[model samples]
Target: MIEINLDVVMLKRHISSKELAKRIGITQANLSILKNNKAKGIRFNTLEKICKELNCNPGDIIKRIS
Candidate 1:
C-alpha cells in the first residue's frame, strides 16, 4: 500500500495544517484529506509545490510498502 508520512513531516517541521496549506497554496480541507490518508490521488504540480515549500524530498512524505 502507498502510505503518506505527512504527519511525521509536520511534526518534524512544527507546521500546522493551516500553515502548510497557506504556504503551499492549498485549502486546509484538502490538507486534512491528505493528512488523514483519505485522498484518492494527488497532482504532481501540487506535490512539487509541497516539496518545495516544505523543503523536503518526496520520499519524506511518502512510502510504498509491501
Candidate 2:
C-alpha cells in the first residue's frame, strides 16, 4: 500500500493546510482530502507543485509499505 506522509512533512515545515493550499493554488478542501488519505488519485502537476512548495521530494511525502 502507498501511504501519504504529507502531514509529517507539513509538521516538519511548520506549514498549515490553508497556507499550503494557497501557495499551491489548490482549495483547502482538496488539500484536506489528500492530507487525510482519502484521495483516490493525484495529478502529477499537483504533486510537482506540492513538492516545490514543501521543498520535499515525492518520496518524502509518499511511502510504499508492505
Candidate 3:
C-alpha cells in the first residue's frame, strides 16, 4: 500500500492544512482526503504544486508499505 505522509511533512514545515491547501490551489476537503490517506490518486500537477509549496520532494509526502 501507498501511505501519504502529508500531515507529517506539514508539521515539520510548521504549515497549517488551510494554508497549504490554499497555496497548492486545492480545496481544503481534497487536501484533507490526501492527508488522511483517503485519496485514491493524485495528479502530477497537483503533486508538483504541493512539492513547490512545501519545499519538499514527492518521497517526503508518499511511501510504500507492506
Give the Cα lDDT of each candidate.
0.90, 0.96, 0.95
* Model 3 lDDT per residue over 1-66, tens place: 999999999999999999999998889999999999999999999999999999999999999999
Rank list by TM-score = 3, 2, 1
Per-residue lDDT of candidate 2, residues 1-66 (tens digit): 888999999999999999999999999999999999999988999999999999999999999999
Misplaced by over 4 Å in model 3 are none
TM-score of 1: 0.92
* Better candidate number, 1 or 3, judged by lDDT: 3
TM-score per model over all chains: 0.92, 0.96, 0.97
For each candidate, C-alpha RMSD in Å? 0.8, 0.6, 0.5
Residue 18 in model 1: lDDT: 90
Which rank order by lDDT, best down to worst? 2, 3, 1
Model 3 residue 50 CA deviation in Å = 0.6
Worst 10 residues of 1 by lDDT: 46-55
Prediction 3 global C-alpha lDDT: 0.95
RMSD of 2: 0.6
Q: Model 1, range 14-57, lDDT digits (tens) per residue?
A: 88889899999989999999988899988999889888878899
Number of backbone-clashing residue pairs for each candidate, in the order shown:
0, 0, 0
